[model samples]
Target chain A: MMTREKFEEAVLPPVVALLVAMLVGDALILLFGQSPGAVYRMLLEGTWGNAYGLGQVLYKATTLTFTGLAVAIGLRAGLFNIGAESQLAAGGFMAAVVGLAIPAGVPALLLLPVYFLAAALAGGAVGALPGWLKARFGAHEVITTIMLNFVVLALLNYLISSRFKVPDTLHTRELASGRLPRLDAFLPAFHGSAANVVLLLALAAAVLVGWFLFRTRAGFELRATGLQPAAAEYGGVKVGRVWWHAMAISGALAGIGGLNYVLGYKGYYEEGFATGAGFLGIAVALVGRSHPVGIVLAALLFATLSQGGLAVNALVPKQMVDVLQAVVIIAVATSVPEVRRLLRGFRRSNDA
Target chain B: MMALAFLTQTLRIAIPYLFAAAGGVMTERVGIIGLTLEGYMLGGAFGAAVGSLATGNPWIGLAAGALGGLVFALLYGLGAIRFRADQVVVGIAVNLLAIGLTRVLLRFLYDSSSNSPRVPGFNVTSSGSGFGALAQNPLVWMGFLALPLVAWILYRTPLGLRIRAVGEHPAAAISLGVPVTRVRWTAVALSGILAGLGGAYLALDQHQFTDQMTALRGFIALAATIFGRWDPKRVALACLLFAAAETLQIHLQGVGAFPSQFVEMIPYVLTIVALAGVVGRAVPPAALGRAPE
Candidate 1:
């Protein structure tokens, strides 16, 4: 009963809502006793004016890109993966341990792969617990994921404070021993930017994920399972396997975000280091409408907001940025009906 | 003596969770998952703190807290029920809004981020002998009483039937001339009231109003609701279980039995294990998360 034109009709509302939100956000700036035009200019300059600022934006984007992909994958499969936060924490913690534990003389080629693998495995394990429960026991992912989040937070708190306490500090040991070699020399151009070779890896993963979702038979099975589990089961798709695989992929992507954080920013993990990056990934996925390319753009937009928000802190409270973010999400969500009605009206007008 | 002390501590801690879980049961029973419990609880805490400080009366503070929660919950109901917004997203937004609003209000009211002026505690009744030492805050008794009251109201009353029917099959109920939206709205409002009371109790009874006062009790209440199979009595028992774990962690610290951090994790770890084990079989309200057509 659905058509491509109807799909387009559904999409238009969110886009219009976003544009309106930007305008309203600017208006909010003016109301807050700041010049909207000046603020916008500062935001642009802070996010992308200098090479360093642009690099920081890109670095932040790279982390968001991976986590956004993680959330998007789960959403596409009809699973709300709120567990991304915990999974990311687990992955980052595991990567930190592995990166720190390795002897100093290990080859970068081997060490990098090992650290990534460790991170992925840790994250995947956390994701699989909920996936298994959902598939086998009919447990809801939302509740399970949320409960797991508390468990992970408590566990991380214990680990960082006691077991893995880096000598005298509350943080882990610095990454002097097993640091991921900076891509500055290799790339030469994007120096001072954490936009490393990992971005390429993230891009490849995104392409592979896209291909798996759209072009492959398993991808079709996953989508079908998500659309209607009863129908998919009747049609002979392995519903359980799809849930597991989707969650595994989702968790791995989230883990990659953690790895990116460690490798790019602190070069070591600290307590509460990833600070809700996993949750922000949810906003990224939603704003992007769960598309790969859309998520990339959403991440960049969010990164810009993050940087710009800090820049404007001199004039307005930084909390206003969060308010704007929340407004954008609400506006986008509410736009669905308005956009649909507008399109219907437009078509009627055209017909008339 | 130690066991008695432990039991008393557990009951005291469980009271707030019991209140919030009861609210969750009411909303979920009407086919609406009440994720705004956190917001309501926090708002209640803030309202109670401010009201008690301004009026110098615990009861007034409690009423104010409940009112704050009711207002926020109504906003949530309007968005989710009237506008047909995504319930989960709206719930998360409400939680974020509550946090921001509370912070902003805190700054406006106290001019300090750390603590609010202490208010008078709720009056407590002392039992004669064996449990006299264990006699806790009056709100604990009120919370316990609410369990049976809620159960009776939910299962035995005509209003309860309507609420259940709305959750189970809203369209069918509507066809039968029931006001489905009204039932859902009322249920959500009631949820807010209960969560707000829980929050007020947290501030007035346990500790003075602090920013992190309601730390994750809202989520824990949600967990208890699911764990208890959305039944008032079972939810109360689940709250007791969590509270017992918390009490044990505290008691263990007194005896130097386990490290503080590890002991603190006991409740969370146990919750995950319990959820993985027991939650798989429990069926939620049939219409939960689905808007009425």
Candidate 2:
């Protein structure tokens, strides 16, 4: 668990960044002749004022949590898995395909495990490729992962469009046994929302990731490698293996994210269903300080901003929310240790 | 005639890549990661479309596009250089900001989300008359010239020497009185201008700016710069090579030789393979991505 000091340190930068980002959003709103106060009020009303909207926010937050963990693990291992966009898609696609392949007489109770394994393996394989390449050939994972995104997405596009696409739709055929019961099944308030069992699963994953990262020896080595690779190598940690396994697990987290939409909501793999979710994960992980508790909170905050984009669309374009998200990232990035040092120097020079 | 047609198509596709790749080479060579190339290009495209639409002149629009990129570059500089923020994260933010800003502006200014109204641009009288179509576009001519000019400035000028010194060893160069920060600022400005012009070319060529129209061209050009190991002449060659692969994709799609998406994957696959040391190892500048202490 994060000590109180660590928690405060982790929370402060993102909180300041959020404030600064909101100021930017205010300026943008004013420039467009809209009242920022009214827009924000409407945004709050649309998102948290009602149970239905809250349910949708939770649904979005659930996916963000998984992707956030995906990225957080990579960060802990000194890797940047920018390829989560395709990794998520690959997981969903593999699950869909495997789900369809199961014989009709198979027990429905066995389906979830099979689909989860299929998704994890698929996402893991794609994630491991860049890791292996970096380890074996000294290739920069940044460029390799970015390139892999295009390659994997293109390959998936080919499969869906030319081979597996349902007759008239852009998505593949529906899965036979991959559906997870929605929250609306039990809760009367979330009647029309997509919130499902996956939300609880996401919570469980967070606890598991936290425990594994903090309590396990493997997690300590991974964090050590991230902090100082040369020192960790001298200390007997297999740096290469940590990177590989961290990436595979990271990919698995993002792959499980795909289930929220594919199994929980849609029951099929639709092209471009979760277009910006993977990138949003970067924002989540960053604001969360790569910690589970922080990640969950950050995901909820972003989920509010995301769903609130639609809520405030009458006052401004939904894209304004995208602008705010980017601004938040910029502010958060500028609040890193390096920038703080620069700020201190600037102040000292001014005083001198 | 057939070969000429093929070459013209490649040249058309290569114009944007050439501009971005050349700019990326300058920025990367100066030791600042040019991850915002995409952002600059997108900003330029949006600027060109708005400028041309307002003024009814492609020349003014082109100038506006360059200015647009300069504006965004300053934003990036504030975060990445002045504040010494994480370059990679800020780069991603800049790109996202460009996309969001353009979309918002598109809706605000043009009342459309997908595209702006058709704007004034260079006239192409002969669609099928080979290079005649490209000959009239001043930006196209400038695009081809940009590579050699960058190469000359890098290899043949005093400023180039200073840039190399700063990139290779900023601390040593600072001791020698080379202004590291100023040199980086200059390189980033030039990168934004040239990459913006590259984006302006796309909007002007199409006579309209669409949201996020630069797509991944900026990335492809950046990849070219890396593939060429940050050498101007070689980077230009890499741009053309990737452009040829794209051209092949289009042609193969037309002929139905392979699935369209698979064909589109060719260039990206090539970049991955080339970066995998199938070609050779790459050594970045010593001071690359490091904030000056």
Clashing pairs in 1: none
Residues A1-101 of candidate 1: C-alpha lDDT, one tens digit per residue: 54976777646655765676678667667656789888888888877886667777787787788888988888888888878888888888898888877
Q: Fnat of candidate 2, please?
A: 0.80
Task: Kindly report which residue stretches of model 2 are placed more than 4 angstroms away from their true locations once superposed.
Answer: A1-8, A103-108, A338-352
- The DockQ-based CAPRI class assigned to model 2 is medium
C-alpha lDDT (0 to 100) for residue A232 of candidate 1 = 93
Instruction: Output per-candidate TM-scores for chain A, rounded to 2 decimals.
Output: 0.91, 0.94
| Top candidate by TM-score | 2
Q: Pick the candidate with the highest lDDT.
A: 2
Model 1 in CAPRI terms: which quality? acceptable
lDDT of 1 by residue, B181-279 (tens): 888888899889889989988988754778657888998888888778888888888888889888888877768777666655555555565556653
Q: Write the per-residue lDDT of candidate 2 for residues A277-304, one digit (tens) a residue.
A: 8788889999898989989999999999
- What TM-score does prediction 1 earn? 0.89
TM-scores of the candidates are 0.89, 0.96
